[model samples]
Target chain A: MNETATQTVVRLDRVGKTYGSGESAVHAVEDVSLELEPGKFFILMGPSGSGKTTLLMLMGCLLRPTSGVVYLFDRKVSGLGEAELPRVRRDNVGFIFQGFNLFPALTALENVEATLNLKGLRGEAARAKARDLLGHIGLAKRLHHLPEDLSGGEKQRVAVARALAGNPPIILADEPTGQLDSKTGRLIVEVLKDLAHNEGRLIFMVSHDTRILGLADRIFTIDDGHLKD
Target chain B: MVSIARKNLFHDKVRLAVALAGITFAVVLITVQVGVYLAFLANASVLIDHTEADIWITAHGLENFDFGRAFSEKKLYEVEEVPGVLWAEKYFLAFGYWKTPTGSQETVQMIGFDPETLVGAPWDIVRGNPQDVKYFNSIFYDEAETNRLGDVPIGGETEINNHRVRVVGITRGAKSFIQSPYIFTSFKNALNLSYVSKGNTVYILVKVAPGASVEAVKQRLKETVKDVDVYTSREFSKKTRDYWMINTGTGVALLSIALMGVVIGTVIVANTIYTSTTEHLKEYGTLKAVGASNWHLYKIILEQAVINSVLGFGLGMFVSYWVIQVMKRGNLQVLLPWPILAGVYVTTLLMCLGSSLLSIYKVTKIDPALVFKS
Candidate 1:
């Protein structure tokens, strides 16, 4: 993906994120800079404790950088207040977690509709949209099933549908296939790859799964808070 | 948003039941305690509440009707001479002992009034008639006191203060809080049984003329009758109730128990809400990651608290209604007025909302970044 031709959805400029202070202070991410453009599957690959999740969080605008600037679609969000950060994330960014963090009490369709509700969509319109998103993720028959009733792969698919409910320009996923079997993990990666290529959405994911590396357009490795291309 | 809140609350039926139980227990405890206290106050002034007199003249420094000395009967003559005083009668009240058939003695409050005018007489006679007291040694006994008074049948004789008295009538719903059975008789017979000398009375019952002001009549009697206290019926009733409730520590004790019920309810509700919030902390983090604001989270929790409060309060009131009915059957007056019920409902709602504060604080502080970790 050429940066000059395509639009840049996420950019991190020499960002540093530190946790705690004094003797116990830990630098989670240091001097990490990157730009992600639309229509590409970008992967942040690292071992455990390599700060991949922290970098993803930083790029997702869920965490503030201790140094340098972070921008989402040319808007600097690293310095935004608590109230403003959520608006930027909700309007432009969608997230998927490794645990498939669906509300156990809500059904799959209701879980997807929750995101639409957060976006101020309501009534039958939101329900129809949620149904379509679940159907697109191959979970049309499982829409009314709860997280506890669905298999792990089905739960991850519901999470995918929920993340896509808002139709944001960028999707940030952290080890979304970590809890699935190899066959299911590959299928999940295929769906995400198709979303980036066909839907023209920027996709950023962090994982240690080498088996899925062939599917990424670009890969960046992080170790001990340092990034390497 | 409300659907999510409803689902979360109904998901765990056992937890929901436990939470409702705690709230119901609190409501019943507080309501019953307050009900009993109100009933006690009502009973303390039962006579003053039911009497037909407009004014009462008692000896000076009389705190209540129970413990007061008899004043000279001549005060009634002076009170009758006051303007607006239509008529007046000497009434007698004194504590005396009655010997039961089993050789056990029971305390009795001997009330004496004019048999001709029937002023200050028992109005709830279940058997016989008020005029029957005109016979010598004739008296009326409360039906509720049949057990303590040895089931004295109508037209039966009993020994009161070593003076033989015949029970010619039975009264209903006239039980006193002091646990002393009331014996109604003629003024002469009461004086004889109480061992009081002739020409003295404990209270002077006065009636005001039609369209006349009771307060004005009370003032006139106070001025004309020297060294005696004059009070309108309402004023005396309040004074009597206050004397027993506030000065005697009964009000404070019952009120403290009721307040304790509120405190216990609040704590139980708060603990339950906090636990539920903690259990769902991860889901909240996911919601934040999916773009839910702090306000959205707050609305969900507030809805949960409100739903619990309404349902639990309804159940509590139902239980309290049954408890009050049981008490009534036992001849214990439990007054559950509409105002008290409304006040308790509002307080219970507030208590449920107050309990959600801790949970709201915890939820609002959940880090959305945690969703990236797992």
Candidate 2:
């Protein structure tokens, strides 16, 4: 890798986030400092209750760092107001969850279109964007299918399409393939890898699959609220 | 945004159907009670309205409708002779109970009108005609009393207060006070039967000359007759209706019932919308995480609530007006006044908005980190 290409898109400095207070307080993320650069396929691995998820959320500007600073594109995030975070999430960051996934009631095309529509696109424009995303994700034919009708792989693909609908610069995906079998999980990883590779987007994911780790440009292991070297 | 809301409403049409059913049921009760009350008010003024006369000359006191009377029935001829008076008809009203041969007694309002003048008759007969008008001494009653008075053959006699009378014809839909049928008879027939003073009646109903205002005639009559009160048809009809509207406890009773319906509708809308959003809490979070601004998600959920409110309102109005086939601003009593309808819509919309705000809790407090490790 060229040293000049490691320019940081996301940076966390001495970030510590604690829930509760005093003796009973629990530190979810402690003194975590990391940099995620553009076009980097980064993986955060951890057991349950580890700070890995917290770190990604901090990078995505969803959660504020407790004691230090976080910067997205050189803009200070830890000091951002509550109202400002929504714009940050909408225009710059994308997220994927594991269990509570796509809005189950909306059709696949609607799910992708809803993201663009939320960003203030009109109905026709949003639909066009959503259809293009679905077509790119190989779900063009299943545009009208609801989540219940979609298999695990198809649902994840819809989720990915939804994430990219707004063309956010950073995609922060939770274990998007956690619920899928090995073959489907590999397919999801390939799609995400393509987004990072061809599109030059920063793709940060929390995954349990070590098989996909080989595809990551960088992988960090986290355990019990601390990063493991 | 609105389109999203409408599509979402269509998405779960079954749930929408269920919610709309609740609103419709409430409207049924509301319209029925309101319609019946208004129908009663309309029936109260039927005798005066059917007279189609311009001016009423009653005793100075004008205490109760049945007990009011002028000093003379001759006053009818005098009013007819007055300048600009086209004609005058003597009208009498009384309240008495009819004890049938079956020993069942019903209280009724008795109306006496002139057959020659054709001033007050069973004009709006639904089932029968006033062919009985030829029999001056016989009585014609509305059909509602037919069940009690028996299908009176034209020649059959019934004892009404120990006096023998011939039954003429059964009126179609005539009920005064909405409980008892009004009994219509000739001027002298009702006078002697109800023990009214000889050659004297309760009031004089006068029809003025063309291009004459009823209020002007009323002012002229009251000026000419010092010891009597003159009222226009609309004025006296409203007076009689107000008498019953206040005395019979209809205002408080129907208002309370309608208020309850509105409250119930608000609660149902609020709870249903709030619960629906609660179920979609995580879904909202996922949307927020995926390039959805707080306002954006809020617009969607709020659109859903407003859609529910509008749908419920449209259905409620339909069921309310369709039941009695009554128009809103017509003579019908189920008045959906502008304020009431507006209040309902505004409050319902607020309820929906308030409930959907609960879903914003999910959006704001949602830790995108919670689902990180899956």
Candidate 3:
């Protein structure tokens, strides 16, 4: 376990994020330092305006930190240009948003296939991979359903399948259960935990629900843009 | 993968219908306007094109074939004696009033030619033979003029310039540019009906000998026949068409309307595509976040535009063909040559592609971060 901890998949060295400049500047995240390893589910708990989502975005490579450095897989990413960030995110991270973010026009199967296409998997290979992923998430029966036709829990399951498409090493979920009932929320969290514990992938989730605290292997509490040990 | 471009365009059926309708309207407007303009030019030079003469000798300062001035008949003999002139004949043309049997009068173009040679004679004769015009005071009237000429029968009698004449033959498709019906007669009878004297003629039609060059013969005729313009048939036809195309504002008006259609179609496409892009902006951001490049996004928008253009152009051509058929019944000529059809297709494509730029610009400005917030 000590050897595994030394191999950090994601590291933030004294990272900070500030919006705007001069008098109207807002310090969203201040001097936060952390290291995350594979095969563990880590959760960040905070209230609104606490910068929990901003910190998750920085880890997912969706947002660049205004100050300090962000390292992913031991590669420096905070210094990379905007044009190079998307490739890093595509190869390393998968995002599950609160809204489920499935294309409204495409079916569940098509949504997952689209992501696989981005990963350069197309034709029969992409189709087979998408089907296998959806089936793994227990959505084989609803493969043809559109987002509008699916229930809230089912939509989240499809989103989970999309996030698991390329089998990325890192999974970033921003309030994945914010819009779900307690039972459905637990079901989604259990599936995410399985991917971390059984598949040895990194699961980094941001949420304010204390109910999920028992399922997390590690938890960090943020208040007023600062993290507490 | 999936054809996201096709899916996005087809998802909103209502918007697609509106865009197609706008493009179809522009195509119809442009086709009809330009078609009529081309038809008018064709009609202006119809007689000159149909004549078998290789060279036309008209009075100097001739504006067009329809407005020929009477030159001396002696130029016919001089033209015949030219080095390359195989034969020369008198052809008379002048405007006259035709008093119907019911005493109603309508203006008509009186054309005179030799019946034996058959040069400058009315073709597609439906009622009587060309030799029938050789009879005393015999003439021919076009069947297309039935509306204005009151459907005169084969032996029908009418008065031209107050002189009584019989309609010995009925010709078809000898339409005039100014909508005046053509009345055909022999040179002897035309001299008695019109104001021109027997020794004067409107034009001298000359044929170039097979072994002689028309240009050299034309030059010789130019020197031999003074105070006259000698032109080949093609040159005369072009000159006549250009006279009407430039002097009359009809050409400019038609072209302006056609250009207006292009502009209106572009605006319609731009507005509709822009609105569609704005509505689906969130989906675009999601695609951006999921590893789609800017080029991929542009392909989606531009592909939608090209599909709209092709579908609309096909439907518009169908409607234009139907309208042209309907106009033919009323003798309103509208021609869609192959070149014009191909030109319209390209124009439609360009209009739609150009209009799609507005939507592409909007998509380029979208920030992928908005997807997480919304």
RMSD of 2: 5.5
Per-candidate DockQ versus the true complex? 0.57, 0.45, 0.47
lDDT per residue as tens, model 1, B1-374: 32787898898888889889989988998899899999888888887778889988889999987775898998877888999998888888999999888879999999898888888888898998888887888999899887788888888898998888898999986778787888899888899889787889999988899999998888878777899999998888988889988999888898888888888888888888888888888888877876778988898889888998898899999999999888776767787799999998898999999999999999988876666656
lDDT of candidates 1 onward, in order: 0.87, 0.73, 0.86
- Flag the better candidate by TM-score, 1 or 2: 1
- Score candidate 1 by lDDT: 0.87
lDDT of 2 by residue, B1-374 (tens): 22545666676767677656655555555555665666667777777777788888887777445455546777766677667677887777766678676777767667777777667888766544464554745888876566655566666777666677787666755666545557888777778677667878788878889998777777777766667778888788888877777766775687678667656755666566666666666777777665566776677778887777677767877776676565423324343446656766675566556656666666566665544434
User: What is the CAPRI rating of model 2's predicted complex?
Assistant: acceptable
Candidate 2's clash total is: 0
Span of 10 residues, lowest total lDDT, candidate 2 chain B? B327-336
State every prediction's TM-score relative to the real structure.
0.90, 0.78, 0.88
lDDT of 3 by residue, A1-229 (tens): 2234447999998989998999999999999999899989998998999988788877877778888899987899999886887688777788888888877778899889988888789999998999999999999999998889999899999989988878788888888998899999999999999989988889999887899899999999888779875
For residue B354, model 1's alpha carbon misses the true position, in angstroms, by: 1.2
Model 2 off-target regions past 4 Å?
Answer: A1-7, A21-25, A123-125, A222-229, B1-14, B48-90, B96-107, B114-135, B138-175, B197-200, B203-239, B309-374
User: TM-score order of candidates, best first?
Assistant: 1, 3, 2
Task: Tell me the native contact fraction for each prediction.
Answer: 0.58, 0.59, 0.35
**Residue range A156-212, candidate 2, lDDT tens digits:** 999899888788878988888889999999998888888887787889898888888
